[model samples]
Target chain A: MKFKTLVRPLLVATAAVGATAVAQPAAKPSPEGVATAAQNVIIDRALLTAFKALPSRFEDAKNPITAEKVELGRMLYFDTRLSKNQDLSCNSCHDLNTFGVDNKPTSTGHKKQLGGRNSPTVYNAGGHTTQFWDGRAANLEEQAKGPILNPVEMAMPSADHVVATIKSIPGYVTAFQKSFPGEADPVTYDNLAKAIGAFERQLVTPSRFDKFLGGDDKALTQVEKAGLKTFLDQGCQTCHYGPALGGSLQKLGLVVPYQAKDQGRFDLTKKESDRMVFRVPTLRNVAKTGPWFHDGSITELQTAVKLMAQHQLGKQLTDTDAKQILAFLDSLTGELPKGYIAKPKLPPSGPKTPKPDPT
Target chain B: MKFKTLVRPLLVATAAVGATAVAQPAAKPSPEGVATAAQNVIIDRALLTAFKALPSRFEDAKNPITAEKVELGRMLYFDTRLSKNQDLSCNSCHDLNTFGVDNKPTSTGHKKQLGGRNSPTVYNAGGHTTQFWDGRAANLEEQAKGPILNPVEMAMPSADHVVATIKSIPGYVTAFQKSFPGEADPVTYDNLAKAIGAFERQLVTPSRFDKFLGGDDKALTQVEKAGLKTFLDQGCQTCHYGPALGGSLQKLGLVVPYQAKDQGRFDLTKKESDRMVFRVPTLRNVAKTGPWFHDGSITELQTAVKLMAQHQLGKQLTDTDAKQILAFLDSLTGELPKGYIAKPKLPPSGPKTPKPDPT
Candidate 1:
């Protein structure tokens, strides 16, 4: 439908989550096109139901967020001293300034070791039901622990090694004490993970799509609204429709076979049905987090979208359809929090701090 | 001569360069003290002539500083695209967040290659007579271009490769144009070095020493003043007395023969006079920019000081004296400009941006 040609009409905005709403035309098209206009209304209503405005925060009942914890987390996030080699920090892989992802196909880790899976954007990741592609870790806190101890990642010798390393840096010890007040010893490995998780929870990114969903009709342009209609019609909303666009588990290469060495969830669970299944990463700041997919094989976003349509939906999209979807996705690029992400003045290492084991 | 017993007196602050200075008693103890005080007067005059307060800026006649160029230089400084592997940058070695060092004995580069020398602190490097430990590069601009192409550093194949890689990122081209206004094309490799140099030239770190040198009598504590006295009396100021503390070139082992595989400046100039000679790095922020020395062989700052006294001055400093000197060096750790060193919002990659060639 030529969306801009149809004048916007006064309609009651739907406030309830998942309730359907549509952009009503000023006047119904002529009698011959009346049926088509009604169908367009149904597609718009589905889009209203499928999408939602971003929430202000993502909360966890088990791991509560606190200002002190978040502040410490910020320092820990930038502290390369956390790594065995004292080179790679959390920011080395999930850079806040660059839409969370390192903008690499695969991130280089301790001793420049490369991991197989691509790093997904940490923006809006707090809302994900599970962390990491394989859903191995149930929450951000659990997910945070894996990398530092991984030989190919931060590469601390062991949990004990990490504890000793943190305890040696006097500034970190003080920060840990302040973050987990009343604890006998707060500089434990678990507390470190919790602090990092708290910081990650605050990394929410909201975009214009959020404003559009909140009933500010002028938030998205006519082309973006048209792109919305196309998205719903093509069933892209089936796997990717929510506050974060996609935060559920889905099978890779559902309809068409994917060619890759990575076994995906099958490698973790050893279950037949779980083959190639992976977490559908949130689409917030998706335009910036590329090359796309679990393997990070795709470089071009349009090519990625086209491939998804063919492999996942068993359908083909026109070049025009791809362009509109891309324009819509561009609206997902949110403003980076200037103050929150400002680089902190990392405290100097104490005399007893261990030197880097760079070998 | 116990420093705590020596009271400060009403006297004109010396304001000369490269003169001598010695801590003197407010009142003469006796006839012997009178002769000592006279000698102290001569030393104090020399100290006034030996050093000057840090200048506000280091202006370059060849390449001037500008707002646009600095802004662009900041992005380039943080951009890892400068490396052949797209995993390293100027920041990788000389991290601004950590007192302009990786805090590693030596930095890890492409494919986890380690350099033969320690990465020097970039802070106050602009004021140095020459860049690089061996004084191979004449200035910051010349030194900026050496790393990316070095086999052990960033490991880019050639200058052409770096130019082509930078050109691929569309945002950098626009930035280059703005930074080098009136030029038909400014994205050349030479301009790349210039922009980075401009950013680095602004990395001057002035500490409490500057305030003391500026005639603020109470700027340094009595102990710090005593430490200064000890530093001067022990003849440590012969090579390390200046705005940057130690920016002049000096023989690495003047009084004692040193053993090392590296030939220092002899490897660069192949002259006998150049043997064991190296550029004396700035002592500003030296407490943080460790492990000390060209080989990064010394991890503790005081040990480095003690070794210098033993080898260069042919003197064994008492534990008390070394402790006092360390306290004074601690005063050299300056405040990091939080806003100026904050991470910048880098421009997004263009469609033409090349993929990483990890091999």
Candidate 2:
């Protein structure tokens, strides 16, 4: 059987499970059509709510997008010599060509060792309320330095070491001076993170969904339009209605009764109310980024949609409703930048040493 | 006391440590300056060797420099969404602006966890006989995949998963088709590594040292010239006389008697003779790529030089000799490609969704 056919039945089975859980005395679906409509309403509301929680634009005012800073930050981002080991660079993860992700469930660092969490995309991170799923950092600048200093991340020892290291490179020193002049140390860690964050702020991809949201009726297909209706009627627009849909923080179990082993924000805030609270992810490129969630537990978008409906909306969804919602999610994919498809210039080859002369 | 004054005496004291380890049976101080003469020999040999390692300029290469491939790879290199946690990227460790390394003793990976060894510079890795400290992989293709699949490196579960993840990205599918056509699956893990490896091959750096090796006498300063003489006169070129300076594998304890926990190639090959054997790293941009060696035990260039003299060459290097050698090494720094610096375009901001909208 084709992949879609196999998936269709699985979706129905899961939806059936949801239907059985929500069967109550107040109302029962006596007809197949009524059951289908009820399921569609549940799925649409849950997804729309998640989508409505995203932000609209790049919010950082101080290091706003400038052609120069972004250009400089881009170079710094790809330069591998930034780590203690010259092996990895920013592109090792969050590959732009791959919708800003490396597709790894977890990342490896300096010595080819595994890390704790999945790498997030910087595509629309400028709209995030805070960085990281746990919300340990308040902004991109604060978020930028965390990995550079983390022993398992970039493994840079200290800010002074980073500054001294950058100063030695005449090209970097010049760039830093031009980017941030008059500062005692232009190449300091603060400036480095700011420069990177500024560059990240420009990674804005506008998808077909945006075109449709902006009132382009023809931008989406009939199925996708139906999916859009389902998405709104089920109350998904409540949380995921923003420009960069779902970049805010939220309690994961607010509508869902599920609990994850990871404490999420509770570890950072030490508050019971903050338990399982995670930064709501952007659904702009949701269809492309999977295995889903911070732990990457959910693999299929259809399964995730069904789970959300039964748990979050306390309603059951059918396979058709889930499929339509997924189609709408797929429409959110955007076009990459013009030059985003090119390879980087490698470092230079040095002088060759001569062979030893035999006496 | 001035910083120089305090450091000068301490340097002399350390010089004695080298003197005791490798003293010639009969030694005489030359009137012309023993250190200067020794420096020139090392520089001359290293320069000649580096020049010969370059591929013939007239060799017709199929995949010549292109705007598309390089730009695509560049974007992939800096994008951080590749990791499971969405926090780290290749640039997290191997930063180009920082001399193709982050200058950390070890790098961090997933959640601020420590990696095993120092990150090597990606610069001129194309010219190395083998990749990594242990010379594990035979070429860049093999080496590139090592990190992506390594539990501690990119931490990708499998190549198939990697392919599926990237295939979800439409723009990537287009780029992969252009880069590699007629394949059943163009965005497979092997192809991804190949694309990245192709980009890495272009990282060849041409330094001032290369100019000098190409017969440009004016490329180096007098102190640097003096250092080159000392490098060869003291037999520093015995093992380091190669295109990559020291990319060939060698035993670590060549001179001084010291034991290390790492068995080097022996661990990989299971051959007793390969114990403590490691690939001699290229000296290109050595000044920028530090804490030095397989274990990153040494922090200072002078200290590293002294240790190599006493252990590898079985000779004592004076302070002046060490200083001159460092100057010669520094000349290996080179400029990155023009327009290598770029601005990354971020994903667009969607409509703003409220933090706790219960719609």
What are the per-residue Cα lDDT tens digits for candidate 2 across A1-359? 11232232211111222222222211232234323433322121212212322233365877765665666677777866566665566767677788887767777876776767778887888776668887777677788777766777666667776666666667777777778867777877788888888877767778877666555667777767667755654545434535676655554533223445676766766543345656767877888877667767677788777766543343456667778778788888877665643444533322331111111
- Chain A only: TM-score per candidate: 0.86, 0.80
- Quick one: best TM-score, which candidate? 1
The TM-score values for the models, in the order shown, are 0.45, 0.43
Model 2 chain A is weakest, by summed lDDT over 10 consecutive residues, at A41-50
lDDT of 2 by residue, B160-191 (tens): 65566566666777777777767776777766
Interface RMSD of each: 37.6, 35.2
Per-residue C-alpha lDDT of model 1 across residues B1-359, encoded as one tens digit per residue = 11211121211111110122111221112233212322222112223324557776677988899988888888888888788788888988999999999988888988998898899988888877667888777678889899988978888889988888888888888989999999988989899999988888888777887787777766777666656755664546555655677665665644333446676766776544355666777788888998888888887787788767654443445556677678778878987766667778888777877666576
Candidate 2 regions with alpha-carbon error over 4 angstroms: A1-359, B1-27, B30-67, B341-359
Candidate 1 steric clashes: 16
